[model samples]
Target chain A: MHMIQSVGIIGCGALGRNLFHNLKPLEGLTVECFCRSIEKDDSLYQSSVRKIEELFHCDLILIAVSDQDIIEVGQILNAYSGIVAHCSGATPLHNFNGKGGVFYPLQSFSRSVIRSFKEIPLFIEGDNEETTIQLYSFAQRLSNQVEQLSSEKRQKLHLAAVVSQNFSNHLIALTQAYLEKEGISFQALIPLLEEGLGNALYQNAREIQSGPARRKDTKTLDAHLSLLKEEKRLLPLYEQLSESIKTYYEEDF
Target chain B: MHMIQSVGIIGCGALGRNLFHNLKPLEGLTVECFCRSIEKDDSLYQSSVRKIEELFHCDLILIAVSDQDIIEVGQILNAYSGIVAHCSGATPLHNFNGKGGVFYPLQSFSRSVIRSFKEIPLFIEGDNEETTIQLYSFAQRLSNQVEQLSSEKRQKLHLAAVVSQNFSNHLIALTQAYLEKEGISFQALIPLLEEGLGNALYQNAREIQSGPARRKDTKTLDAHLSLLKEEKRLLPLYEQLSESIKTYYEEDF
Candidate 1:
């Protein structure tokens, strides 16, 4: 917790790599990244890659691996005396060993996309006040937004996040699949999708909801189900999703 | 089928009002709007209000009422000599009797908000070629994007639209409800939602999906389900949506 003079990042995935580059430029801090299987030599952060043992000497060790790998990586740092934090929104703060903390960057990151961490919200939590302040100051150096959130609230945030981001993406993917199955151009829905998104952003989504499900129009529902009957994969999805919507808004009518 | 010099609009809902005001200023087009129960006097389109008997005099009659009323309105317009068109995406073109057609403006409409139809896709269909051409020209005068779509294809579009627009809106509303219930700020998820939407727009949504469901991370899924167990409404939604996503990507693994 002493000024975080040295920082170590595990995993070379999107979040880990971005964190490495973003933190490396800060003055008076030695940065290192540990990758189990490093990529080709042509990568940008190749020079910063280090073995796991070298990271044990750092002031803070941050794990940015997959959900399945988080526990293993945390176990590997059992001997390390430094604060061990994770970059996952879903994973608990207890996954690590001594001085456990969370440095969750709550945003969508991709290997192909270069993201600026300045605008990303960094939710930090530490096992103790000292470690919390350490992570807070550490996060301040990289991002404009930093907040100390409890693990319970952070987990709930993660759940809401799945509903907000992943579920919407899957719905869109399903729509695209439906359009492709019908031999229709996906471009036709783009404008409507944009408008719908704009409306949801500016207005409360529940009040703005419109469809056969929202109206409980049995006739249209039956007709749509009849059309989707041929699509074995999509028919159940349509039924379940519509049923869910109908149930959600049943009290209004 | 002749020149649509006189345009009569039925219903005074969001779409009807907007269409009335939009078409009123056009040259050589006498626009009249007929509302079953007109609003208070001082409303913008109050002067354009007329009875169903008066609508029978126009060259084109557009019924823009709710789905359940479409049939009754169409029946009432059977004696009208002009082209009777229903402005709906789900309703088939056969609802009307004489010169049946559709002038479905495929976009979100609201009574409180003013919308421009220039970018909205106007899908037009008619009983015959001459009527289609007449409707096409009339649509061209209102908005830029216009196309001739079949009743069958238009019905399919309406279904896909419910999936793409309404389903996503409901998902967001669910997320908002979850955040509010957990005493978390909804603003925290905005950037993430925007990023996810951007990724979906630029990349294939099926490929960009990242979550416990997409990764099939059972541990995280279990943790989330445990947290959601208290909410009876969201629990089943989480189960069904995740199950659908898992089943959809089962072939990938």
Candidate 2:
């Protein structure tokens, strides 16, 4: 890898913009950002995000667009002679030309919040050994934890991330709505949740799994099912989730 | 309500044992433990847990038994002349004659962990005003957060708790198992989960809901489904959960 000095970031969504600002502090690195329209805050990226053609010759070009746009963006950056990577878990390394790679950050980014990139896990992959090392070194500069993950392994990781982070968060949100509808304070459950999650983390989630479904307490489960009779929307979800729990614990592996 | 000087706790399960140990420190209160058989650790409860006859005459007998056993224990204490509260979210207040009440703690307890009982929310319910106040004041001594919740409301609270804490914890367990199967360190996902959860709590889970399903990104969603195909048990769960997420956000009310 030639002594990489300049980096180009595409898109100004949550991740793209954040990477542009976060990478600016690296020693002797000139960061440039490209987007269709340059917003006021996006000026942090080399004064303003210009055009994609301006980024073609940079030492490294990272496409921070959505999964659907990754292939198109990669094609647009096809002329680039440097390493071209798309920060996507779903998109593969072969989406771009010979030098294409991946620089995916596992954490979900918010457009408004400028967060420290140090703790986020960045998964890197490249077309070849040289590109792999180049991409790994670049990702290591942004996040302390960087792994050389393949397209298949990275997809599995993304699926796990979706179920654990996104699904659990949605479940909490449903509970929040339930409590609010019942005229109960959602704050009442926060202490209990914190303690439960703490115990799960400490003792391991498998060892400490409990509740009516885990216990196979038919009476309690039936009572809950009846309680959700009016909540037709949540009824099927509750059933599906309960069935999954039972299948996991009760069935033979 | 008479100044309850004596308290009797029945059963030696996780919540029961924990409550018995925690309530021992209340100033000027005599606490007795009554279980079928006393184990070595049961010595902390008035030297040892004895027969149910000994707990019958106590000023306040808290039946810390399972939901199914609450009625039996309440009947055994029916000969008493004071508040007989069953510390159950599932069992109602009408189980223990006119003196029947509820002293349910909202947090799950482990038998081995002697956790500080300060922050756990205790929901109190009684058949009458006198019993309600008696249980409320008694519970206030045990935990800082005490509320007079009706049986219906407490049932609703318990349902919310089941879905939020228990279900979400199980999701993480599944994710852990998946990551382990792939020979990936579960530690990699922790940082992302913590950061994502923090943002969800701060901004709101509903506002921060992002994932293939939520975005209606069929390509990524299909990729995840196929990835989970090798995991036969998890494939249905993946589909159902994704469907629920789509229903919650994508569909019109």
Candidate 3:
């Protein structure tokens, strides 16, 4: 059994709170926390400290603060002898001086939506081998899909994640907004959405892409464009996407 | 028992082939097909008619052709003394003069990928109430989820489907392309992709959107923008989407 006696967490935000809940329940792991605002409910996991210096005694310290606060949090814990890690996908691990690593959990977390960490991909990176091993084991405890990635690769992965999740959600939102304006049911698009994502699991999305744009159906494309003529912002988006799809298939054929 | 005695499918494309496989197995339904090219393999799914006029004799003739071909197919079967339906989401039901409706299955189909029609949403629209009930019962034999939609609403649904499936797939392909150029593993983004899409099934994507733009982190946004300096096409898309996300949150906050 690998030993991880005490883990310190900074910042009690959604990610931090989730980490606390998941870690506190694991056997042989004592979780200590420090946050700016100590709530009464936070005491259920463990008593959180008021100062950052108090958490320096732990075997591992996890900085679960915002991206802006990461550098400041690292500076605050500069003298800490314990291993340090920040849970961020975009932020560079080199922002910290020593013994720093990344512990990014790739999921959109909400307070209301409780997600099991068992399947969540945990991307970890460390400055050195020993720290990497420890970080890997730490992540392995929470997730089956634990990957060790470099800072540069992790940054690229973060960009992809942003596109795959945030951008896709915005597109779906735009779709819903457009449909609602015309008194159409959003339910009509759910099956298509599910089927599209389901196809991605079995094949490359490029191969399974189906639409007027993919087929280069100029008539249907013109019709769709005409409908979006009133919306200046959306018109360009539709045109660009349709043009790109057309260009992609044009290149292929 | 719901009697869909004889069903005729026009066009033996991926969608038509899939429909044939799913509908042919049903005990109460007999599926006949018509394709532009009558291939040897297609003989397994009943004898496909070489001409469209041959299908007009069936109880229900389904024009499962391309969007561009729907009008042409409709004209070919103008004097058909039976219910005629085109399996298209975008093409207006008005394209056909008489005895025509819609029997659209909301999915992306490929010859290699076999999907069950039981869970697939079949959108049915008819020229009249009697035709609507007949179409509904016909759809019920294959799928549990059958919905009646008007031409106007179905048009909007088609627009939404374009955005949800086609647009999302394009964004994912772009992400993969970007990551591949940097020697980053596409595998890193899979978990995030799966989680994001899975969340869409349970929650509205707008509520769970997360990224630098959603957080309005200008620093990280600039970093990502700078990284895409060489890729002029992707840079504009990235900037526009990020700006949209920022503006969306700015309104809320």
Candidate 4:
């Protein structure tokens, strides 16, 4: 696999914008960002070209549009014979028309958050070995953690990621909301939350598990449930998650 | 309220051991640990006094036993007239005898993990103003983030801590298990996990939430459920948590 000379990014959303910014500075990598908006003093990569055909001059085209629009972008690039990929974790490789590949970064990005691509784990899957190697080489330039995964396995990884990120964040949100109702500030819980994450990273979660649910402290559990009774939406989640924790620990006990 | 001259810790578990180590280094604070084990030329503050009455010598007695043993420790300390506090977050102030107070650190501690008390949110509550001020001054020596919280509010905070720590760690465990089965390393997901925690700390979780669940993508959800069918324990948690996310976002849509 050789160094990628040029790369084209479609869409200017968080993923695309970050991708463009990350790839733009890499040596021997010329990035062209295609978007609807254009400025007179736009960067060298920013292009107002709406025609997908005109922007197919790059060695690779990275689709960073919405999930629904990914297939359409692939279809529009069907005429091009160059390597094509989408930055979607959940989407399958078959969505692309030609030289299909997935260059999904297992990360949650926002316009405001200045995230470095150095440690972001990238999952690349392609229609064939050649495409996979090409995308892997391209991804390696942007991130140190790059691996080749099958579409099936990548989908599973994506699902696991949803649990690790979205579901975990939801639990934190529940914590914040519960404390807010009690006139306690959210900042107070940050240390506990950070320590919890640190423990999860370094230790086995099973051994490190604590709380009323894991301890089977019915009194504390009942007190929490009573406190959450008024929170109709949270009550069910609290019960379900706590019940799961209890069930998991009870097996060992 | 001016300063704590001497302190007694009642347990030798993770919290008690760590507290003794942290407090022993502070100026003007002499920590006497009351544990079962006694050693010759033991470190400063390692007092293996089997007699509970000997703990009454300190200005304050901090009970650091397990939740079940807290009441018994408090009962033993019923004869003492000095300020008494339990380090248990879930246990209320009423559980203690004499001048009761709470000196709860909002951080998780493990035997193997070396954690500093600095910046750890210290939630303190006493039966009365005098006890509260005395404990506050003592807590100030150990940490900068100290606050006075009512028992009712601290119990709610404990519940919130359980969600943020236990439930979230369970999700990370789930991630590790899933990835390991696929021959993927846990280290691969650390960046994403760290980023997710950073997001929850700084941004609004609801606004930053992402995934097929947030998008209500039924196709991906079905695929994930099928993949998780073999995981009897994790499947239900996956379904319930995803459903909760779906429900939360659906209301807005």
Q: Considering only N, C-alpha and C atoms within 3 Å, which residue pairs clash in candidate 4?
A: none
Report the lDDT of model 2 for residue A205.
85
Name the runs in model 1 displaced over 4 angstroms. none
- Candidate of highest DockQ: 4
For candidate 3, the docking band is: medium
Best candidate according to TM-score: 2
Please write out the lDDT profile of model 1 over residues B1-253, one tens digit for every residue. Answer: 3578998888889998878878888899998888877656636555565568777889999898998898888888868888988988888887366588999998878887767788888999999888899999999998898999998988998898887788888888888888888798877777888878766865689988889998899998999999998888678878888988888987662
lDDT tens digits, residues B140-212, model 2? 8888999999999999899988988888888888888888889887787887777666555545677678898
Candidate 2 vs candidate 3: the lDDT winner is 2
Per-residue error at B245 for model 1, in Å? 1.4
- Which window of ten consecutive residues has the lowest lDDT sum in model 1 chain A? A42-51
In CAPRI terms, model 4 is classed as: medium
Predicted candidate 1 versus true structure: per-residue lDDT over A1-253, tens digit per residue: 2699999889888888788778888999988888778757636455555569888889998898997888888888888998999888988787365599999988978777768789889999998889999999989998999999998999999999998788888888887877777777667677888878766866788988989999999999999999988887668768887888888876562
Tens digits of per-residue lDDT for model 3, A17-57: 78888888888988988888775764533558778898878
lDDT of 3: 0.79
What TM-score fits each model?
0.94, 0.96, 0.91, 0.92
Q: Which model, 1 or 3, shows the larger TM-score?
A: 1
DockQ of 3: 0.61
lDDT of each: 0.84, 0.81, 0.79, 0.81
Rate residue A160 of model 2 by lDDT: 88
TM-score of chain B of 3: 0.93
Per-residue lDDT value at B71 in model 2: 74
lDDT (Cα, 0-100) at B142 in candidate 3: 86
